[model samples]
Target: MSLSAAVRLRPGPVDLTSVETDAAPGFEGRKADGEAALAAMGAELAELQERLFAEGQSGGRRSVLLVLQGMDTSGKGGTLRHTVGLVDPQGVRITSFKAPTEEERAHDFLWRIERALPLPGILGVFDRSHYEDVLIARVRSLAPPEEIERRYTAINELEQRLVDGGTTVVKCMLHISAAEQKERLLARLDDPTKYWKFNPGDIDERTQWPRYREAYEVALERTHTEAAPWHVVPADKKWFRNLAIGTLLLEALRGLDPQWPAPDFDIDEQRGRLLDEAPIA
Candidate 1:
């Protein structure tokens, strides 16, 4: 299947013009066996993550940056929780960007993001990222129109720089419908345990869904590039979401072909020395 076709299968807020996927073999619509696909992909990701960990430990000079952006209650946190759990904790780092603090605001938009970039031999996941400058800033009217426009160019340049420097960036925008979001918010409100997840601001933002959608449309159009293309994952089905994201990540990691580093010395010689030093059993 083509990239466009694959995207059509998943649910997420997307600007089709911004989407560029070369023909790739995959399911285009909702897979009837999505649950099974997810389970299989989850297993594959687990195995690949181990390989990435080993390679990174061996001084492998590669890194991965997984960026997750979506509306409130779109399952970004839940996705991170399950997806990151499949990787070696020591080899992965997760950063959740909330409202900016005075310190964060002091720096340029990408400064906080740059500081969070994964070091060689690790995977870094940004819960919400630099995209906020476009998404939130545009919706909330936090910046001048000129400043907002400038950020789009600046962000594209920054991501391109990272890609050129050996960072493999997998950017995913979780697409959930407004109606679905409303349902999720209501679920959170009604469930006592999930009540903590509710915030009045969420409802306030819902009223501006169309505005935010337009903001995302522009954000995706301006920033999606060959170097760091965005993938819109269908988030309405949490299981399918996990599977799709996990599959994409596993594919990227496996494609890198990371392997364990060779031992520094002869294993036989080391074993012999240990045997000679030991007392009779």
Candidate 2:
């Protein structure tokens, strides 16, 4: 089965806690094997991204948007460094959402999201997304209960619209165990080089781990759709997380079947023109 089909959460209630954070769901290999697989995908991944980028510049309307959601130290950053790194930077547009500014808050929750969408042919990745309006808002009571409820429907509609507009939406929830998260947090504290990465607020967030898990369950259940289903990637092992996401992205790109656009101009004429032209130098 395709990785997309394998990791996709079915439309219904979900139990995030039930997923094994260290297990590689569809993959049968160990860490070394996973790393090797990811390495092998590098060339094709780069080629596809370049084709997709070229297609966009050639007036193709299709694009891709990868939505990655997870808790602290769930390897969102690592995905960027490893999985996403396989593709050319020119083809990718990344957005790391933070607490909204007053300007952003003044508008609807998705207002900023609309602006962050990847242009045609580009791959857009969101570290955290409008789901925050539902996840964090619900957990922290940052918005009215009814408002949070309304955002779920809005998110679904927006994703569907994006699909109709030729953007393939790939959503992945990096699932990490609480114990693993604690260890990762402690590792940061133990390393002087990683001290800057440490966040006291993350520990505060940990205090509400149960609430956050419940919030994620609700968000996944309510917003998961055929238009853009959520993939629960096992993230405790960095190698598996990178390999899975890389495979997922490669599959999505291949599904688009993006190809090099035929030259719009006459190749023979351009070649002759180039040969006849005098060098300015």
lDDT top scorer: 2
Whole-model lDDT values for every prediction: 0.79, 0.92
* TM-score to true structure, per model: 0.88, 0.97
TM-score of 2: 0.97
**Candidate 2 clash total?**
0
> Over the stretch 42-104, how does candidate 2's per-residue lDDT look in tens digits?
999899989999999999999999999999999999999999988889889999999999999
Regions of candidate 2 where Cα sits further than 4 Å from its true position: 278-281
Q: After superposition, how far is residue 26 of candidate 2 from its true place, in Å?
A: 1.1
Among the numbered candidates, top TM-score falls to 2
Model 1 error, position 241 (Å): 1.3
Model 2 C-alpha RMSD vs. true structure (Å) is 1.2
